[model samples]
Target: MRVTQMLIPTLREVPAEADTISHQLLLRSGMVRKVAAGIYTLLPLGNRVVKKIENIVREEMDRAGGVELQLPIVQPAELWRQSGRWDVYGPEMYRLQDRHGRDFCLGPTHEEIITSLFSQEVNSYRQLPLLLYQIHNKYRDERRPRFGLLRGREFIMKDLYSFDKDEESLEISYRKMYDAYNRIFSRCSLDFRAVEADSGAIGGDVSHEFMVIADTGEDAINFCSECDYAANMEKTPCHIHEKELVEEEGPLELVATPEARTVQDVASDLQVNTEQVLKSLFYNVDGKLVVVLVRGDRLVNETKVINYLGANRLDTADSEEMLNNFGIPMGFAGPVGLREKTAVTILGDLEVKCLFNAVAGANKTGYHYINVNPQRDYQVDHYGDFRVAEEGDPCPCCGAPLQVQRGIEVGHIFKLGTKYSEAMGATILDEHGKEIPVIMGCYGIGVTRTMAAAVEQSNDENGIIWPAAISPFDVLIMAVNQRDELQAEFALNLYQKLKRAGIDVLYDDRQERPGVKFKDADLIGYPVRIVIGKKAISEGLVELKWRATGELIFKEKDKIIAYLQENLTAMKSSKR
Candidate 1:
């Protein structure tokens, strides 16, 4: 594509709303433009990048035996009701009523629709296993969408679903999808890891997220230093190092804390270790008021609480409701005196239960109970792990300290089993004539997010350093000055030669300054750049520069095509 003919709206300044590097650069580089807050219009460059990423996902899925088929983006509410997700899918789904007053929703996912299709079509054991996939736009009304394509409400996605006869057959299907995911990301040249993750609202027992490592990522991952154990921080299991309880348990005594409200304030004012303070948090979990206790230094993982209770939603208790209904102030809530409020259930962390002589609130203003023991001082309805896993905590599998990493999730695969099929009654007849629900597995790749993540991990200060497989173009041919006859002739010849050799080449033939052309070339981040200068053209040679490595080599005009072909072969082999 010629620079003069194509729409590469390069910008010299960054926009105010662009926060992350990918977001800032894509906008400044003219790859994308904002349509709304989390929505964007993909310009020519951005569209090309997204298409390349989608093609990679398509190739890998097809190789894994997936048949391509498109599903409806707008689904009937009746279908969701059959899967019991109509009310469960919360506010993220965009719901609407047609003119006839039938409820419908823009699909954030297609599980219910796909399952309903399978239930009606496949009813025999002969079609025991099936792999189907589609690439399309997904909708989600993100409460606070940011980071450009990373969290857009309307974004391109590749979703694949598998149907199998039994658990063993489902395992095979899951493995195939997992292997395909690895190849898809690998082909995109992403620096990523596949970590075990919670199945969130997808309602599965096992899941894994493919995360691209970046400093600006939103997801936190915990990896063991000594083993292959890796998982999302919210899902990582902790082996709490047991500390000996105070052998001589001290007596519980109430003291005037004056104005100590926060855990830090109370710990510092009383001159006690923060670990000795039991921080209490009141929550309204699915309409049930629950009290939770954790170490002062630890944080509550709300996902663990939500999954543990099997509730669709979890929220903190309203400050006004707590004070008005239970006479418990926000910062002063504790288990003590809550026995009178029988509606409130108390759940404590496993370590909190064994703590002795801990400090807790008196459930009143400016008062606290010191040397407070768990069983004697306060009652706990249950004991379990409720705190977020932190760095330096021992891994559940290996007793080594966990290393925390920041990563952007690009893909996820789940062993959904019969969650959707059973709910929707999607069953097939067995060989013995017995009917059974179809076992399922789901796989998804955020195509646009993967492209943005590639920019996140691979770019430098200049611009995006795209990989050869997923770059908008493999090579960029530019002349020092389009008006210079020798330089222009050499550049045009090289461009045509590379194109004939099956290389995707971008020819910059605009009458622009050499500096501007070079800057734009670097910003676009084509893998290989071939420069035709007055000196090289006179010498029958051209200069080749590596966008990623910043290495420059000079080759004769006749042999440069051969050199590029050889380099491209090596690049393809390395991705494999």
Candidate 2:
């Protein structure tokens, strides 16, 4: 492709609206442009990169026994209602009404539609073990879309749904997808980890997210220092290590703690460690108020709380809400008289029970109770692991201290069991002739998000260092001086040769300054660059530069093509 013929609107100044590095570089590189708040239009270069990534995902899915098919983007409300997710998705789903007043929605996911299709088309177990997949657009009306492609409302995705007759068969399909996802990300040259994750509205008991490690990532992941155990922060289990209380319990006494509202403030006023202070937090769990107690140093893992209570929604109760509704003090709330005061269920962390004569709020402003023991002064309706996993926390698998890192979620695989199949009545007959809901598994790769994540994981100030396998063009052929007949002739000839040799090469034949071309080339981030400068004209050598390593070498003109052919091939096939 020739640069003069292409719409490569490389920008010198960063756009003001671009927040993330990927978003800024994408706009400046002329790869994509914002069409709306959460929508974008992919230019030629961006489209090429997306297509290449899709090809890699498609190949992997096919190798895993997936059959490619397209499902309707506009899904009927009845399908979602049958699966009991019509209101569950709520405002996130893009809903509309047709001329006939029939309700429809742009699908944020295809579980309901695919399961419904299976129920009507396949009945016998012979048709089981089906893996249907498609690379298509998904729609979600994000309440606050930011971070460019990372959290876009409209984006491309490759989702594969597996159907099997039994749990054993489902395991096979799940393993296939798991292995395939590993290869796909590896091929894309992503520095990622497959961590245990919550399925959320997807409705699965077991799931794993392929996260690309980046400093700007929104998700925190905890990985064991001594083992392979890694999980999303929300999913990492906090194992209870009960410590026997050594101090004897004493009578609880209320004392003046004026102006000490926060945990740190209370600990400072009492001249004790934060761990000696009990932290009481109120939450509205499915319309009921509940008090959760943890050590002052620990934070509430709301995901764990939601899973434990089997609640649809969980939100923190502020001081005003507690005061107005339950007649409880917000900043000075405690479990000692919480049950008697409001009769709200107290969900206590196991670590809290280990404290002896702990200091706690008196549920009254400007007052605290010292020598507050768990069973002696207060009662816990339930004791469980309710704290967030942090650095140095013991790993559930190996007891090693955990390490924390930030990562962007690019892909997720779920062992859906029979959630969708049962809800939609998608059943299959077993060899024993008994009708049973089909076991399911779902795998998805965020096509656009993965492209953006690649930039997030691997980039420098120069521009985006795209993986060789997914770069828009494998090599860039440009002349330092178009007016120089020797350089132009050589660059044009080399471009033709590279094209003939089956290399995706871009030729900068425009009448532009060498500096501008160089900056644009680096910004666009072609993996390999070939410069036809004085060296090519005088010494029969070309200047070769690698975008990733910034390595520049003088190569003989005759051997340049051969070197690139072998080098590019290896770069694309290299595993992570």
Candidate 1: list runs displaced more than 4 Å.
Answer: 241-244
**Candidate models: Cα lDDT each:** 0.88, 0.92
Give a tens-digit lDDT track for model 2, residues 23-115: 999999999999999899999999999999999999999898999999999999999999999988879999999999999999999999899
Clash total of candidate 2: 0
Q: TM-scores of the models, in the given order?
A: 0.98, 0.98
Instruction: For candidate 2, give the lDDT of residue 343.
Output: 62
* Tens digit per residue, CA lDDT, model 1, 34-112: 9998899999989999998888888889999999999999999999999888998889899999999999999999999
User: Candidate 1 local accuracy as lDDT?
Assistant: 0.88
Q: Once model 2 is optimally superposed onto the true structure by TM-score, how far is the C-alpha of residue 383 displaced, in angstroms?
A: 0.4
Q: List the pairs of residues colliding in candidate 2.
A: none
Residue 12 CA displacement from its true place in model 2, Å = 1.2
